[model samples]
Target: MIFIHPTAEVSDKAKIGDGTKIWHHAQIRENAEIGENCNIGKGVYIDFGVKIGNNCKIQNYVSVYHGVVIEDDVFIGPSVTFTNDLYPRAFIWSEEKVSKTLIKKGASIGANSTLICGITIGKFALIGAGSVVTKDVPDYALVYGNPAKITCFVCECGRKLENFEDNKKDNLVKGICKFCKKEIFINKNNFKKWKK
Candidate 1:
């Protein structure tokens, strides 16, 4: 059974899975689908047509707008915002121009990050606090800054790899994760994750 706080407002058309908890002052719009065991924190606003999968946790004061799809085991920190439309037009026919964004499975965004429209954040990607994500982030990558640049790769255990002076293949500069004690190898072309 889902647990919705009395202060939260969940629309009749919204579908909340089992064991999901909507905390104080949260608002889930019509047609939104939140999966099982999800923790929705205080003052979250999930807009129409938004889809969130299992075991996701959204922290306080976040606004997840339309055209955003969140996969399983994702952690969205406090005050994180997801935007849909690039331009603002209240009474205009601009809804057709809205671009969708996808946050793949196991991705985590730190507090106060902003995800722009039309971007797909890859699986297990980590966005640091106060980042403004303007482009697609690769899987298992740790990114920071206003425009969001790849600083390094972080493991599931949450440790950044150390840099080695010799043997570049064994260094964190090459995007190896120390926490998981594994190497993350990417294809030669686009530097996308393949998990070596």
Candidate 2:
């Protein structure tokens, strides 16, 4: 049930799951694995051996380069950039030199954000627009800065749970999401989804 646009170039070796739609002018490379119910937007380029999990939305003009792994239920906003090389040189073509990036499940990457390689963006994290992520983001973190600092903790539905700026050290705050009614617990070191 995969729908590939007529102008799209999908390799025969790529594994596209059911209910996925690849839009116009998109290119899916060999050995790429895309899971079910995903949207690959126009002019998007999925590099060889890149893995994308189920229920994902990758918007227009996104460059999912090699060594990037996207987990299920992720939202990648328009024009997001993923870089693979730590020190890129035009003359050097080394596959082993490229660093890996992992976007965990239920995470949302805002538009025009740049994710540097060798970082694992944790589950349910929200990355704000135009951010340049240089390090690993914790789960349920609301991060937005030039280097992407954790400003707050948020629920899975994108509601801010607690402010880290107001309370910096060793304390716990419990919050209930207004939209989804999910309970969240935030401490100095972790953000947890609590069920009671």
Candidate 3:
């Protein structure tokens, strides 16, 4: 039961899973694989060979370039741009120069963000609007800003955690969500890697 809008250009070589809907003017390139029950909004561009997992929502005009892999339950907001090349020259382009990006399951990327290539966005991470993510983000991190830094850790429900404390013995940072009352733990080493 996949639905593709009449104005959308979906290549026959692309594989769209069941219950997916591609909206007006969207383009899904050759060999791209979009998993089940995904919503691709108007004017979105999914580049060749890109892989998107199940139940993802990609908002209008978002550009997912080649070599980007998005896991299940990801939310990519409007106008988000994913880059595949570290160096860009109009006349110098080759597939070998394309760097890969991995957005782990359950991550939310806010509107108008730009993600540089070769970075792995961790599971359940929340990226704020207008962010420019230049490096890897830790799991459950809340990141925002020009070079998106981890401000805090969030619960799986996307609620900010409170009463953050580090346990030196185990090298873990622990926080509890006020709303969900869920205990979240992040490895100290991984937290330190992106805390800047």
Off by over 4 Å in 2: 163-174, 186-196
Full candidate order by TM-score, most accurate first = 3, 2, 1
**Best-fitting candidate, measured by TM-score?**
3
Colliding pairs, model 2: none
Better of 2 and 3 by lDDT: 3
* Better candidate by TM-score, 1 or 2: 2
TM-score of 3: 0.95
Candidate 3: which pairs clash?
none
Best by lDDT: 3
Q: Write the per-residue lDDT of candidate 1 for residues 1-196, one digit (tens) a residue.
A: 9999999999999999999999999999999999999999999999999999999999999999989999999999999999887886777656697899999999999999999999999888899999999999977778889999888666665576554222355423344665665765433322423222
Poorest lDDT segment (10 consecutive residues) of candidate 3: 187-196
Residue-pair clash count for candidate 3: 0
Cα deviation at 52, candidate 2, in Å, is 0.2
How do these models rank on lDDT, best leading? 3, 2, 1
What does each candidate score in C-alpha RMSD?
A: 4.3, 4.7, 1.5
lDDT of 3 by residue, 7-40 (tens): 9999999999999999999999999999999999
